[model samples]
Target: MALDSNENSDKSIHKFESMLKTDDVYFFDAEDFEDIIHHYLNNGKVSLGKKAIQFGLQQHPHSVELKLLHVEVLVFEDKFEEAGKWLDELQNIDSHNEEIYVQRANIQSKLDNHKKAVELLQQALELTDDSFDIHSLLGMEYLFMDDYEKAKLSFMRCVEFDDRDYASLYNVVYCFEFMEDYDGAIRYLNDYLERNPYCEVAWHQLGKMYFSKQMYQEALAAFDFAIISDDSFLGAYFEKGKVLEKLGKYREAIDCYETTIEIDDPTSHAFLRIGKCHEELGNDDLAKYYFYNTVHEDPLLDKGWLAITEFYFRKKQYKKALHYINKAINIDGENARYWKKCAEIYSALKNFDEADFAYKQTVDLGNFELDTWKNWVTVLQKTADFNTAEQVLLQAIEFYPEEAILYYQLTLVYLASDKPHEARKKLKSSMELNAEMVTHFKTDLMKYNRFSWITAIFADDKKASA
Candidate 1:
């Protein structure tokens, strides 16, 4: 009889404890709910946190914590105007609520009102007696402004108040890195590694810093540690592959790019790096295959076409280069740069008529480079359009008066028109300008290297005089 009575009493006690947990406390405990909401917000559970806060708001309709949390939730959702509206609500609820003003300041910061944010933070500093988060927030505002030195000071204060939080310490490492204070970054990162050996972001950052300083071996060590910290670390793989390439380990670099591609990232730049590695290994056919795949896979990538064109251009295959350049130009017909490239390849093949037309189109479509215009003149001379050719040469001279070769070319244009005296005068002027070309070459003044072209016109003089 006594054992049964004891069991029933224990069951009742358990039931009452469960009821108390489910029931709202008679005493207002807004801080407890605020802390819970903050935890969820930081952990990316905004929806669940919002729901919990809504329930708390209903329980305590006049609580400043509820309104502040609502504003924070709106900010997390990127509803800036809605956040401002709630911020206004918070200020109205109780103008004397110091926490409400600080929360409003946070919303203003999110709205990118830096001046107002600083003013509010300063005011909050006095009200909260220089609270650690307010100082951190000030530092964060400066950090967003890329003020690394001031950001470092803010993070330092954060650590002083709460030494256990890793985030502020992490900011210190980042600030040092951005400031180019590499020694300080390395020292702090090493110290942090003692407590957090698996901090992949810090390790990855250290590798990048050392890499920039050309400390290749040390960079490799840091990247390797970062990769080991997280096996699926794509950033670490990219860094490691870059270092490997610098070390002339092309094969290893190729493997790393392949692994990154296998991770199924559709927008992977790994294909680009992999193709370059194949090109370095003297497997141009394989390199071309990858480049073509990259182009077809991501049809909008200009880099893919550029890679394909460069491969053949490097191989001295002008026809193959022209084919790809034309294809690239077709995709973006108004792209003057591609048209210029097409014109260049045509010039290389001595297909001057086509090259001139392409260059004209390039200039028409907004290419204004001196080199492009000079290329135009060279193509025109090859095509025997001395009239058009002279105009282009004059444009070059007009822009660059010190070019003696341009004046020399102008003399050729006059001689082509059978005006010998005019040609001689211009030749003398060209020699005066350059001085080094006075006795250079006799036969260079002919159009397109076909010196015999002048004879057909001069033959008329021979008949008339006879």
Candidate 2:
């Protein structure tokens, strides 16, 4: 009975061994094992790969390939400390082995020691006469190190060894771009296109390099090819739109921006460009609607608020402009432009106290523009805070000593505050800058000089505080 059982077990083992070897066909259990590994790798299931590797070892004990793959799986799992143990075991068994060195390099690359990875790959290069993969890996390591010159050299070697590799050609082109060799980048990419006509990244990068060099038409053509190759290439479409914008093709630019917005809603720049394109095409309502949509999509985006604020400002809608600009300030209170816009709107609305506060906020944010200084003086003077107004005017004069408006403004503040003696000192400064200051001031203020709206408040001291 024991012998019969032993014979049956032996037959079953023989059948299993036969099944493991592929007989003139690729169908085998080993193929299933590789599929599992690939699935684990693609899904980032490092633990499962590790467990699978252990189970696979029981079936195929002498597979050095599997052992090597297990190390890769450990590294992918971010179990670098554990991967080190496998490396030590591999080193002891196969010291000076080229493949072991490459595996170690891959492990080191995962740990971000790219320089060490490159040095290890160089050693592997000495062992193999025709090693395109070793060179490609070296290029990838150098790219990670930001050594674009070395990366380009290594990637060029990979192309020479295996020009069929599209990624290798693309890597060399990217290195040229990173090194700022626009001509070299274009030349290599063009050569690559002649060999592999469907390289999408090369097409996109060629467009980007040409755009950077101010070759707009060539950029458009390259982007055309890139978008044709991958219809969902949002970045390529965006570049195409920007090139069209620079070439004064507003309608085509709008189409490209709209296309990109359809694919990529998270891009704040796309919405902004589309809104500007609509504005350029004399579509104010469409522009305003898209600007509002951008704000709805990303409430935290400063550009969205700026766009909406500018929309209202352009329409002379001071209150709406103030609302959006104030929302912008609330989102990011330190922004100088929002504070300035709010101050301008409040001044236009005759909200003098709020205008003073807004101008002071702009000043606090270090905005020292000439007009910003002028606005500050106007708001302070309107508030009957002539003391602060004089201080602000002097600061403006310090920066713009020859500005006729600063001296004239100081004179206005003094004359308005019932201090003609202080007004006389400012009058001399005004006279030095302007032979016609009094005429211009009187002429400009004549429209609003009907001080019924302005003087009603200054008629009482507590009026300003109110």
Candidate 3:
């Protein structure tokens, strides 16, 4: 019906355009002018739409509809004040015209007056028998107000009016998901599927809901159904692979990911996931091949480079790991994970200076993990940079004030720096925080046993505890 209407409008539009070309006066009815103006406006030909409206108003001087179209064009051009005045005049001429109220709502929505927009849409809903568009608009207003329940209800009505309204269906699901009602989303999608059995989108969404809840078998079934409904559904194939991975079916997961590549162009994400699956299945050669493909497909993808770096690192190929990690850091120097990995690879290769620099970068990039601080301090100590090691431990203590290990490590730093007074103070603090950590301190203290004053302090603490 809509296509036929557009076709009919196209004929009127052609006639109107032909008349304009020949300086001929064409006589068209008010409805034909409306269709011609609407065709131009819908196709984004605003100047032509305005010309049609001018010609239309000339022919049908009392046409409320053409005047309303003029108001719509004004609103589209963001001439809200003029549009509002025209709407007011048109409403007085035709008090019950729903388009006036809808146009008012549109202007209000554009001005960020969502509440007023909702009230105006409510008025339009009362005046119109077909309320799908009004309901959709109300849903958007409710969403802007963060009223998920009302938004859900409005979009649900749209879905009920037209089950093929996938946009409204997605909005309904979004409302449910935002409210954290995963079970409700699953139930709603299941009910919708009962009425529309071949809805691949609903099936795919249902799969995601189940996946969020860790219902792997159900998610797998839903994704499989989505694929059955539409064999070339790339999203379903990709999600099915993720579910298979969670189920420890690596080979099957690889096949599902491979199917997505066959259905469409290969994405770097797919290549990366396939590489991970092959690695999990102990296929190093295939993993390496796909990992390379992943980076080649998208050099800017930090994950791909990190994956290749970690693969080599796990194999104890520190040189290869360092090489790839440098590339990853170059791609995303701000990424703490990349810097952390770079630090670890340098440490594995016993490059203390470079490792220390990478560790400092990792921390500066806001990675305050406990092991990050600990590893960074250890690198400084390895380089015999006692003063820097002391400063790093002091900073780590600020982050982990109650951590006994940090205090104990600080005590080690003090002893290394030949500060007996500071060393004893830190040792006491560590003992108070956690006395059991003293044993680990003792193992580290073996090198500093020449400091008899440190030995005396330990003996005094042990005696006091006894």
Measured against the true structure, the TM-scores of the candidates, in listed sequence, are 0.60, 0.61, 0.75
The residue-by-residue lDDT of candidate 2 on 28-85, one tens digit each, is 2543454555555556666655655665666676666567777777666688788778
Worst 10 residues of 1 by lDDT: 1-10
lDDT of 1 by residue, 354-442 (tens): 89989988988888787887778778877889889877777777777887877777887777766677777777788789755733534
Sorted on lDDT, highest at the top, how do the candidates line up? Answer: 3, 2, 1
Which structure among the candidates has the greatest TM-score? 3
Ranking by TM-score: 3, 2, 1
> In model 3, which regions exceed 4 Å deviation?
1-5, 16-30, 33-77, 325-466
Report the error of model 3 at residue 231, Å: 2.1
Which clashing pairs does model 2 show? none
Estimate the overall C-alpha local distance difference test score of candidate 1. 0.75
Global lDDT scores for all candidate models = 0.75, 0.78, 0.91
Cα displacement (angstroms), candidate 1, residue 372, comes to 8.1
In model 1, which runs have C-alpha deviations exceeding 4 angstroms?
A: 1-59, 72-99, 110-112, 125-140, 143-146, 152-184, 261-267, 326-466
